[model samples]
Target: MANIAPPVEDIAPDALLDASSSLLSEHPDKDRLFEQLAISADRAAVAGAADTAVGLAALAVQVLEEIGGEPARLGTALAALGRLEYERGNPDLEPLERAADLCDDLDEPVVSATAYAYLGAALVALDRPGDALAAVSWSLAEQERVLRVQPELRPTLKPVRAEADRARGLACRALGRAPEAMDYLARAVEAALPRTPAQRLKIAEAATLLVEDLLAEERPEEAMPYAEIAITALGDGFAVKAALGRQRLIRCHLMAGGLAAAHPLIEALIEEARAVPGDLTFRAVLADSLAQSAELLPLLAEDGGERAAERGRESVAIYDELLAAGVEAEGVHTGRAAAALALAYALELCGKHADAVAPLREAVDTLERYAPGNEQLTGYLARALLMLGDALVESGQAMEAAEVLRRATELEPVTTPPR
Candidate 1:
C-alpha cells in the first residue's frame, strides 16, 4: 500500500538530492519495471515436465543444430544460459539446450527458421558479425522458401515475420547498411505485434540500430523519438541501454548547438566510464566526448580576436589527454578522435591571423599518421584537412591553404557519425 508522504518542508537536502539522483529520476519507473522483470523471470524459470516446457525445451536443441556448435554462437548461448542459470539458482543449461534440440525435431521449416533466428542472435551478441550474418541469412532463406511453397505453415510464419525482419534489420545495421537496415526495421515496428522476451530483445536491437542510423543521416530530430522508444523498452539497468542513452542525450544537445547545456549528461557518462575498470571503448570515446563537448565554447574574441590562441588552448588540453591515454597504440579511431577535436577548434579561430603554424600542422600531422584507410577514418581525415587549410590561410600561406582545401573536397562527403 502507498503511504502518506511527509511535507516538502520536512525533507533534508541530502534526502532530496539522493532522491533526485535515483534511477526513477533518470528513467521512468525503472526500479519498478526491473522488479517486475525479475518477478516474471522467477516465475517462468521454473520448468515443469508440462507439455509447454517440454516443447520449448526441445526447440532449444534444434537451434543448436542450425548453429553447428560454433564458438561464437556457443558463447552467446552460454551467456543466455548463464542468465537463466542465475535466475534458477542452479546449473541449468537444460532449458537452452532443450530449445536447441527442439529446433532440430520440429518438422516445419518455418518453426525451424524462427529457432535459427534466436540462435543467430546469440552469435550477434558475441561480436561475431560474420557468423551472425551467415546465420541470419540462412534463417531468412529457410523462412522464404517455406513461406512460398508450404503455405500450411503460414499460421506460425506470419506471426514470426516481424521478428525475422527485426533480427535481420539489426544484423544489417551492425554490418553498416543504414538505409537498408531501416527499411526492414520499419516493417517490424509497424507490425505492432506482441513480443515474447525473445522478440522484445530484437525490438530493442532494431530500435537502437534505427536510432544510430537516424543520427548518421544528420537527423537526430528524426532519431529522438526512436531513442525514446528504445529507452522506454530497454530501461536503464542494462549496460548497452545505459551507454546508448548517454550518447543520445549528448547528441541531442550537439544537434541544437547546445553542447554547454549537455555538461551534466557528459559528466555522467565520463563518471560511468571511470567507474568501469579498464573500459577501453569507454575511455577512447570519453576523450572524443570531451572534444565533441567543447562545441559550445565561444569562438569570438575581442580586438585581434585571440581566436587561434583560445582554440590552441582547447586543442592542447585534448592532446594532453590523448597522450595520457597512450592513444598512438589505440588505432586510427582513437587518434582521429583527438585530431578531429583540434581541427574543429582551429577552423573556428581561422580569422585570428595567429601563428596557426603549430596547432594546424600538429592536427594534420597527427591525423595523417593515425588515420588508416577505414571508411570512418577517411571522413575524419577530410575534416582535418579542411581545418588545416584554414590554418594555412591564417598564417599568410593563402596558396597552400587553397590547395589543401581543394584536396579536402575530393574526399567522400561525411554525413553522419560513425558507429
Candidate 2:
C-alpha cells in the first residue's frame, strides 16, 4: 500500500504527535510519518509555537535518518531543524553545516542552493561573516545554474534569491566591503517585491535592512525612501519588526530635518507602544523612541522645550523602571544611560543647567558602573562627561567643571591647533 500523508494544518500539535506515534506503531510508513511531522512542524512555526515546531522538526529528522535513502530529504530536514533552532535563539551551526555537505553530494542544484543559503544565514547570525559570504556565494552560483537550466522557476525562486542576497549583503557589510554590501542590499530589495502577504513582509524586512545600512553610512536621504517602503509594507502589523520599521522611518525624517513629519509618527509610536502588553524589550524600545523624540522636539516648535522636557522625564522614568525590574540585558544599561543623557539635554535646552547636572552625573555614573573600560562604550561615556562638565560650568561649579572636562579630554582627546 502507498503511504498517504495526513492533513497536518487542522490538527493541534499534541494531537498530531499522538496520532503520529500511533501511525508509526501501526502502519510504520516512515515517509508518510516524516511528511506529516515536517508539515506539522512548519505549521506550528507559522503559528508561533516554536517549541512544538522544534520538537516536530526533530522527530521528522529522526524519521528521515531511519529511512536513510534520500540524502536530499535528510539535508532538507536538517536545514529546517537548524533554522528553527536559530530562530529559537539556540543557534547550533552543526546541523546547517552538515546539511550543506549532504546536499552538495547530490545532483540537485535547487536543494543544494537552498541548503547553502540556509547555512549562510545561520553563519551570518553566528557572526562568522567570512563563512557566511562563502556559503552564500555558493548558493548564488547554484541558483544561477538552476536558473540557466530552468528559466520557468525564476518567479518561484525570487524569494530564495532575495534571502541569499540579503545574507550576502550582511556578510559583506560585516567584512567592511561597503560598496558590495550596498549593491547586494539593493538587489535584495529589488528581488523582494511583494507578490503575497509573506512576500510583503519580506519586502519590509529587506527595505528595513537597507534603511539601516544607509542611515549608518550617513546617507539619510538615501535611506528615507526605503524607510518609507518598510513602513508602508508593514501596514497594520504590530510586530516588533513593524515597530522597528516605523522607528526607522521616524529617524529618517529626523535626520533629514523633517521634524514636523517625525512628530506625529513619534506620537503614534508612543500610543502603539502603550498598547503592547508584557513585552519588556518593546517597552525599552519605546523609552528610546521617547528620548529621540524629546531630543528632536526642542528644535521643532516654540513650545517644544516644555514638551521635550516632559518626554525626556518619561523616557528616564521608563528606563528607571526597567533597571529596577532587574532587566540586565545587553543594551538595557546603555539605554538607561542614554535616557538620562537625553533628559539632561532637554533640561539644558530649557535653560535649567542646575536641573540637568544630576541627570548628566547619573549618565556618567551608569556607564562607569555598568560598562567600565568597554571600548565600545568609551565614546558615550566621554560625551556624558563632556555634557556634565558643561552643566557644571553653567551651574557655577567651575572647579568641578574643570575636573570633569579633564576626565573627558583624557578619555577622548580634543585636538587643538597651536596658537
Candidate 3:
C-alpha cells in the first residue's frame, strides 16, 4: 500500500475552501454537492492534507446517508477514502468493503470492481493472502465484465485493473505460487509504466518481490534482470530499497559463481550497511554475511587463515556490540555459533590447533543449547563437534577427543562438494 499514489491534484487549501463554501452557500443539488465534496477530498489527499481529505469525505458520506443520494456516488466517495488510507500504508478494509457492498447494491460494476481491488490490497497488508486472492479474483472478473460491456470505460478502469493484477500477484506469491506470481507481476509492471514517481515506486517494489521469488527458487540467472530493474527504479532517493536490491544482486552473483564480482559488491554493501542510522542490526547482519562470503576468498594475495580470521573477528565484534545494545540473545545464537566456528576454522588453517579448541567448544555448546533435537541444525552441530574433536586430539586431549568424536558420529554426517 505504501506504493500507491494519492489522487493527482494540486489545489490550494484556502482557495479550495472558499470556492466550495461559496458554491454550497447557493444550495447546490444534493447529489451534485456530494460529487463536489468527493472531488475536494481527493484533491486534498493528493496535496498531502490527509486530515482535510478525511473531513471532506466524512461530510460527503454524511450527506449521502441523510439525503438518500445515489448509492454508486456514495460508494465512489467511500472508495476514495479507502485509496487515501492505502496510499498512507495502513488501509482500513471496513470502508472499502462497505463501498463494494454499496456499489453492488447499485449494480455499478466499475466502482465495485475498484472497491474490491482496494479491499484485496488491504487484505494483503493484513497477511490474509487466501482472502486477498479471492477478492482480487472477483475484482478481475468484474473488470472483465465491465470492459466487455462498456468499452468506453477503459480509460477510467485500466489503472484500477492493473492495481488488481498487482494485488493478485502479491497474494499468489504469498501462497507459494511463484511462477504464476511472476507472470502476473510482470504484466502489472508493464501496465504501470509511464506513471508518476510515486506510482513507479510500486512497480519497483513489485519487481523486487518477483526477484525474491526467483532467487528463492534458485533461479539466480532468471532473477538478475528484475533485480537490475528494481535497483534502477528505486533511483537515489530511497536508500533502503537500493540497498536491498544491491544485496540481492550480490547474492545472485555469488550463487552464479561470479566470486570476483561478488567480492567488490559485498564490500560496497558492508560500507552502506555501516552508514545506515537508527539501528545496528543491518550492520551486524552484514558483518556476518561478509564473514561467510570471505571463506571463498583466495590464498594467493592473502593466506586463508589471515583472511578468515580478519572476517571472523569483525563479525564477533559486531555481534558483541549487538548483544551489548540489548539485542535478544536468542535471536543471535546462530550468528554467534557461526562466528565462533569460523574463528576456530581460521585457527586450524594456521596450524594453531590448540588455540582453535576454545572457539570450537563454544560453538558446539551454543548450538547444543539452542538447537538440540532440531534436524535442520544437525549438520551445523555435527561440524562443530567434529572440529572440536580434531582440535582436542591435536592438543593431546585423547579422552576428550574420543568423547567428542563419539557425539559427532551419533549425529548425521553431511557431505560438501569440492570447491
Candidate 4:
C-alpha cells in the first residue's frame, strides 16, 4: 500500500473527496483516509455545513496526531477547523491563529493564506477592524505569491479572495476610508457569485454601501438602482440587509413624492428594530423617518393627530432608550433631535402648547450642540426655535416669545414653510 497520498494539485475541491475516498477504500491507507477526511470537511464547509466540517476536521486532526506529527497533514486538518470556526463567528482567535502558524511553519502558502483570510474575518466579527485589516492584508500578500508560483491555484483561492476583500472593505469602512472601502467592496462583489446566501451577502453589502453613499450625496434618484439590487439579491433571510434595503427604499419613496408607500415601511422597520436588541442604528433611522413623515400625516389620515402623536411618542421613547444606553453617535443624536421636534409638533396638534415647549428647546439644544453649523440642521433648528416661540405665546408668555421668535428669524432666511 502507498502510505502517502498523491499531491492534491490540479484536483477540484468538490471532486477531491470522492477521489480520496476511492483510494482509501481500495488501499486501506492512512494518508488516503486523512486526505479524504480533509476534503470531506472542506466540502461540508463550502456547503454551509459548518458544524459537520468541524467534526470531520477534528477527527482528521486526531488521526494525524495518533499516526505521527505530520506537518502537512496536521496543517490541512487544522486549517479546515479554523475556517469553520471563523464562519461560525467564534470570538476566540486561538484556532485560526494556531492554524495560520502551523501552515506558515509547513511552508504551505495557500493554506496559510486561507487561514489568515479566515482569521481576518473572525477579527472583523470580533469588531477589531484594525487587526482585521492587518490579517486580511497578510492573506492577500501570501495569495499573491501563491498565485505567482501556481497560476492554477486561482479556482481554489476564490473563497479566500472574496472573504479577504470583504474583510478589508469592512475594516476600511469602519475606519472612515469610504473610497477605499467602496473599491474593495466592489472587488468583493466581483469575486463572489450571487448564488448562495453567503455569496449574495457580499453583493448585498457592497450595493447597500454604494446606495448609502449616493443617498448621503443627495442623489436618491441615482441610489434607487443599487437599493433594488441589494433588496433583490438579499432575498428574505437577511435581516440586516433587508432592514437597510427597506430603509433606503423608504427614503427614496419620500424623495420621489410617495409618502403613502413610505409610511408603513417606516412603521415596520420601527417594530422590527424594537424586536432586535443590537439594531440601535436602524432604530434611530426608523425614528428619524417617522418624525419626517409626521408632517404628512394630517394629509394622509382623518385621525392624523392621534396617529402622529403615537408615532412621535414611540420615536421619542426609542431615542430616550438609546441615549440612556450611552449611545452618543452622531446618528443617534440627530434622530433624538428630530424626534424632539416631532414630539413637540404632536403636542401642539393636541392643543398642549405649554407641554410642547420643553421638547422644542431640546431639539434646538441637541441640534446646536451636536451638529453645529450644519445646513440641514440649521433649518430644523430655526423651525424648532419658532415652534418654541409659538408655544410660549400660546402659554401667555408674550415677552419671552418675542425674543425667541426674533432669534429664530435672525438665524436663517424663511426658506422653510410654516410647520
Per lDDT, the best of the predicted structures is 2
Clashes of 3: 0
Cα lDDT tens digits, model 2, 335-367, are 777777778878887799999999889889878
The better-scoring model by TM-score among 2 and 4 is 2
Per-candidate local distance difference test = 0.53, 0.78, 0.74, 0.74
Residues 238-273, model 4: lDDT tens digits: 777687687888777776667777778776776776
Candidate 3 lDDT, 372-407, residue by residue in tens: 676546677888899999999999999999999999
The true-versus-predicted C-alpha distance at residue 368 of model 1, in Å, is: 3.1
Least accurate 10 contiguous residues by lDDT in model 2: 410-419
User: Model 3, stretches more than 4 Å misplaced?
Assistant: 1-73, 105-108, 124-134, 149-159, 169-258, 299-303, 329-331, 372-376, 394-399, 415-419
TM-score of each: 0.49, 0.70, 0.72, 0.63
What's the true lDDT of residue 101 in model 2?
Answer: 86
Where is model 4 more than 4 Å wrong at Cα? 1-59, 68-76, 90-116, 119-157, 171-177, 193-245, 248-261, 270-292, 296-306, 317-336, 343-362, 365-379, 390-397, 409-419
Instruction: Show where candidate 1 strays beyond 4 Å.
Output: 1-165, 168-203, 213-222, 232-234, 239-241, 248-282, 299-355, 369-386, 396-419
Q: Which pairs of residues have clashing backbones in candidate 4?
A: none
TM-score of 1: 0.49
Ranking by TM-score: 3, 2, 4, 1
Q: Which is the winner by TM-score between candidate 3 and candidate 4? A: 3
lDDT by residue (tens digit), candidate 1, 1-419:
11225422233323322343332233343333233323333334342212222222223323444336543333333334433442223333343334445555545455456555555555555555566566567667878889789778766665456656665666777787767779988777656354333334446657777777777677776776676666555543356555656677577656755545566676577567656636655655555554543433332222132343343354356446556777656453344444344444544555543454565566666666555675666666677677678767767789988989998898788753422
Worst 10 residues of 4 by lDDT: 1-10
Please identify which of the two predictions, 1 or 4, would achieve the higher TM-score against the true structure: 4
Q: Name model 2 segments beyond 4 Å from true.
A: 1-10, 28-31, 64-105, 193-210, 225-245, 276-283, 293-298, 302-306, 319-419
